[model samples]
Target: MATDSPHPTRKALRRNVLALLAVLAALLATLVSVSSASAAPTPTIVLVHGAFADSTGWDGVATRLSSKGYPVQRFDNPLRGPAHDSALLEKKLAAIDGPIVLVGHSYGGMVITNVDDPDVVANVYIAAFAPAQGEFVQGLLNPIVYPGSRLLPPALQVKVVDDPTGVAGRNLDGYIARPYFREVFAQDVSVATAADMFAHQKSAALVANLEPSGPASWTRVPSWYLVSGQDRVIPPALQRFMASRVAPGHTSEVGASHVSMVSHPAAVTAVIEKAATA
Candidate 1:
């Protein structure tokens, strides 16, 4: 007897998983916890992109969720800073009725946490920062900013610009310097891909980074966290600390860069779907 062997393709594997998920969803009503196995008709999944990125970065995750029959949408985060940006997010959330599973990547986590809308029943942090009360995005990046960070060459750098978004309402805007974007934020992506991501980055206002958060929404809403272990933008240690603060058994660690949601969409979507059903 001869055994047939062929290398499995990523697409083939994904299709298999999608099929399994569909079966599980069909049986969720009886075989599993309705809150955990469901892949549809639960809460809406909202994807929020962080700095040095646009909503397009969520394409992969959104596609996965869509394939699973889950309603998904990506919001264009105006990196106007936290308070103002969160307010804008609140407005967007207002347009989306019913329960929501808010998922944010990078700085977008700050915005979602700050929004804290009641409609948002759950939050998913995808290689994201979930700052505690009084914490700021810039403050978290200070180690990488001022130097002595563990990584050589320091993975990230920021620059201040005039309020280009117009929504910032502040004098200084913060942008991730393009020079290190590929190595820092999207290290898992290719040069050509990273270039496109860099080109589409939206700058956050400096005040947005300096502005401290109020009480965190995670404290009120159940949350899930996905930490990209190879992240250079926001140290992985910080990601773990934040994830620990969330509900236990709701955190996962994936080996990827800061932009893990793009590089590892399946992992990211699984977490979001978990939150949506939970």
Candidate 2:
């Protein structure tokens, strides 16, 4: 054997070099796989504000999402009729590159229900309406939806503003009366903050709530719902019914108001994130 041992050290060195090269190749492949998985984009979360509220109500939720590296959109729902609002949302959605988790509060829920968006992974309702096809929000708020509901009557809590343009049903806006704003919408929020929010209230068209909604997006998309146990704008009973209808197992509740995003943003944000990751 020793007689055949020419350049044995060199042969041994070559073998070791080949083994090291194979190890590097395997490590490189593993790195590439992990890189691909990590590169996949996460979804965007869009929050649609309801009537008597604006996109600013979602400030806390938006900040939380942004800090966690999620792309957040606080949409200003026009408070127009369902079809018109849905059309605008659909067009805006066309520009987004990734998936979306659409969240709606109060009347905004009706708006989201009207849109047919394939990109929406899930619809998250936050003490919001979930009207079926041909069901108007105004009708749902009446005794027919949740008969024993004690939410403030719209006629008393809202100030009716006539359309200055003389359009009969177009711009008849309704603003939440400042005096009842605390009890009706933001009871859970601090008095100072509630007052500030009331000062900047945005009016919604009275006709918009009266208009009928189209087919519900929940018919196709998966959904998560958060019921504010003490919600005054949208009754707790109505919220529970909607939640059960949309997503039975995915529903949660907090002892908050209709503006839960402000009073209990953590709970609202958690539900939204659950949908996004799902």
Candidate 3:
């Protein structure tokens, strides 16, 4: 039997090479898996505050979301008007890469509804005004249509401001009078916190509420609504009315005020995270 065989060293070397190749293959597979997982996109959570409040209202929510490994952005709404704010938001959204979970509070809802961006995968309303096309925020805030709204005189104070755009009567800034800020906008938060929020409140121009919303993105995109059960600014009834228009079972209710994200950050974060995953 003339069986030819490699030298012992060569055979050992060949065995070592095979083992090294197997190790390399396993390592390469693991690296690919890690790369794919790290590359998986997690939608950015964009928070926009509505009338009588600023981006600070989203501090709690943003912190909670960040803790859970979700990217959060609190938009500095100009509070000019839906037409202007939405346009600005559209531009802002355009700059962001990957899917987005757009969450709006108060007038911010109006602005988000008007924005038409493919990146916005979900529209989450936190006691925000989700107006339909041709419908204005003011119209939805009507005390008659949805009573219990306290965002009226005594509670709301309007001041005429110089319009850089030179449009007469379009530059009015509406603030929730200091006395009623807590009750009207954030009743669930502490008095001190509410006062701080009031002091830093960003008023929306009257025209912002009056300007009719354009094509509502909610109609096309998936929407998640969180109704502030104790909200007096938009009225809980009105919130439900708007929520009803969204996809069924996408509505959540928290027994908080207009600023649920402030009063119940965990709940708000959960809703937004759900939307992000969805």
Best by lDDT: 3
lDDT of 2 by residue, 140-221 (tens): 8776656644444552354446554327633557776766788777888999989888876788877787888899999889
Clashes of 3: 1
Cα deviation at 222, candidate 3, in Å, is: 0.4
Q: Please tell me which model should have the higher lDDT, number 2 or number 3.
A: 3
Residue pairs with backbone overlap in model 3 = 50-107
Q: Per-prediction TM-score, please?
A: 0.78, 0.84, 0.85
Clashing residue pair totals per candidate (backbone < 3 A): 1, 0, 1
lDDT tens digits, residues 94-179, model 3? 88999898999878888899888888899998888888889997788787778898778988888887767437634778788888
To one decimal, what is the Cα RMSD in angstroms of model 1 from the true structure? 14.4
Highest TM-score against the true fold, candidate: 3
Supply candidate 2's per-residue lDDT for 247.
85
Error in Å for residue 35 of model 3: 7.3
**Which ranges of candidate 2 are over 4 A from the true structure?**
1-33, 144-170
Instruction: Report the poorest 10 consecutive residues by lDDT, candidate 3.
Output: 163-172
What lDDT score belongs to each candidate, Candidate 1 first?
Answer: 0.79, 0.84, 0.86
